[model samples]
Target: MKLPESQVAALNAASATDETPIDRLAEEAGLKPETATQAVFELRDEGLLEVTERESVEYELTDEGAEYVESGLPEVRLYRTAVEAGTDDAPAQMGRIIGASGLEGPEIDIALANFGRKGYGDIDSGELSADPDADADDDPEAAALAALAEGGAVDDVDADVLDQLVSRNLLDRHERVVRTITLTDAGVTALMEGIETAETVDRLTPEMLTSGEWQDVEFTEYNVEADAPEVRGGKTHVLRQTAERVKDVLVGMGFQEMEGPHADADFWINDCLFMPQDHPARTHWDRFALDVPPIEHLPEDLVDRVESAHREGVGEDGDGYHSPWSEDFARAVALRGHTTSLSMRYLSGTEVGELEPPQRYFSVEKVYRNDTLDATHLLEFFQIEGWVMAENLSVRDLMGTFVEFYEQFGITDIQFKPHYNPYTEPSFELFGKHPTTGELIEIGNSGMFRDEVLEPLGVEHDVMAWGLALERLAMLTTGAEDIRDLHGTLADLDFLRGAEVTY
Candidate 1:
């Protein structure tokens, strides 16, 4: 049998009687660890070697531990300074010793507390004195940390000292799997039968392939199932992909896309949506207000109409807030909490042209909220906002639209709970059963726009609208347990790399 040079060398180095680590075999064979690992797996597949794996914890020094190794440990430095400045009978001021040790901030507290705990010194009445009997050189944690500063297995150090170093945040420990390679009975037979590892080619060159001498050359066997090196080509982000899919689905459903700024006036985000200026949602706790460049150039006529809606209500039976409503408050620039702002802009004929009956508009865009982050909530995320303007749109139309939209992504189980929104009358909160957990997850909110909201926008037709969390949909589609892992910094690269894109 013939093999690559790496595989041949690894097979020859394997122990027939006793187990040997792959690292040891690699070193003896003058091969790289990864190269040896590949060779070992290849040989194992061919019944020419046996491999075993065991997991162990390995420890390495942290940045602070490395710094202490160069200088001394914080307590060691404090002890040395105390010994130099004071005798056994006459202790130096604790503050003076700390300043002289060059430790600052939290390091000073660390130095003082650990110095006494290690029996290296004493602190009393603002005075510092060395133990006289305590030897800095005899410190086990410092010695262990110094040894590990260069890096080694955790088992190589004293457990007590390792614990102390870990507690001090001086070392990081993580589990590592060790592979041991050995010669099986079949391996010994293969060795005795004479194996060859020379002039094996992984790829065929044009010259070799064309030449008659190619007949004498050995071509490497291909394992099609073997993992290839990762080739990261340009691709849209996972969240962006979800957004695009949503756009395609909506466009397929005959909805025109809406576009607008991530930051907009509260007039459209709130006032036009019938959300009062003094509403708690407009406060700093729920909205991120911009400091520079207050929103201006709003259409004067539309401003008066919206202001009237806020101050006294709109049209017949429209009883406005009658509370203090300032145009300045409506013009305050802030990050949008939902893309419903885009829907409002569209419905009000502010972005595009005048709204016509039976027109459908949708936007999958980013929105910002002053929210506490967790497994399901993010401060910034994309919202799937869409609205349909038609004569007498009903709640069934709203629910049906949601079902059809989510159905495109294979989410079939949907339920709606009666909910409330200032702009949307008879609102409902959309829910979807989690694919994995089987729990009903709140997906979005939807309803028919109230007369108060539509009238100010000159939109007289009954309009159904929705604001769904794009991240939650992405989470449902990608089987992501934590919303952070769907698109944020904490996202799992492995999951993204292997995630199957379902239409």
Candidate 2:
């Protein structure tokens, strides 16, 4: 079920021929190729396969494999011998395709005996047969293919041999594809004898569509559609939709929308916030810095204050903090690491002077980090960064904001543990129990700006800065197991189209 709707749509091999290989079964089953293949092995594992390894490389499982595959539990395999010979206890049609040509049993024996006793030249099974001796070894592969072809799909390679033949005059092992194809639930059903589709009927339309009751009915007309239910879907782009919903939640709570350029200098980013020049985060490796005409000036007053602070502890301790300010560092351009950088920028920009009681602002945008990408991490991602400027915006005010944001997501169990961030004093990381998996997942970080960081910027009252990771929020809201789901390219339109969300 963790499989996204896009993945479900791509699993098409379920409708393929039974003889098709597992690698190519994806399309028919309406699943990814890998999903189909995995489904095949699953069927076999569950004691549902009647595998017939007709060829050395490929094995064919009977209809049981196909049945199990379609049932969605393809991981079960019930393997049986490829073929069986006739015996006293054996059935009349053991391993035989027909009465005798493919059947191997006592019935074949009786037919062969009746003919052989009449001085028949040859006998096979229970039939008077002209035994054709074939030297398949003359062309081992060709013979195998011919035999496999006549036997009807050796487990999964249903494609024509000519395709492989066209590849070359000289057979290269590397060029060869050695893989097994198994029938999915649909494929097995299709290959089964007497398997007939329902009589074509006019698609039953809902009265709502015809009555013009729903003008927003934007669904495309489908001439034909399989009844098979795909992982249910249709929604806004998962990330963007979730972003909008989250935006609404904050905005509804009186948060003004804020925006900033993707690129910013250290002055607005980290410098004005009192990030030490020698801090590792300000290093070139940590930030995506720009080199064009390096060095931009900070606000003259702010610059003087910052410079004076470096010259002498500008705030609480104007002693040890007195160090040299790096204009170059301030000038250095880089992609914003945290949206908190933007919050800083917004605060430094032309202001509303004071909170005037209470003022809130927020933004949902991309942030860049020079870090290794993994299931839980990415190089670039969106962040929902915001802050509330209030006359009495204390640590409690920030916590209230957290509660308000999560409540909109229908989340109630919040873990507000004290943590630390470079820019915010008395910082804390907010964690919420994941709805699906009760695991504690960190959603965002929040705290009050330190006076050392604020005083240099000017006219600043208490402004709380909280930079939220969008991926984490999505993981919390959608119960997505992987953070990459937010940025997945294979994602289908329905993956995020009409999701249940709240403001």
Every candidate's CA RMSD: 11.7, 24.9
lDDT of each: 0.81, 0.55
Best by TM-score: 1
Clashing pairs in 1: 312-320, 313-320
Tell me, by lDDT, which candidate is best. Answer: 1
lDDT of 1 by residue, 1-503 (tens): 87789888998899899898988999999998877777888888988888888988878788888888888888888888888886455887666787888988667656765776688866654567788888888788877877776564456667878766765667776656778888999999988999887777767779976786678887766655543454667667788888889999999999998899888988878888888888888886678899877787888888888787887886678788867788888888999999888888887787877977889988888898766455677668888888899997799888888889888999888898999898888899988877788777888998888888887788778999898998888878988887856665346555676675475
User: How many angstroms is residue 174 displaced in model 2 relative to the true structure, after the best TM-score fit?
Assistant: 26
Shift of residue 476 alpha carbon in model 1, Å: 2.2
Q: What does the lDDT come to for candidate 1?
A: 0.81
Error of 1 at 216 (Å): 4.4
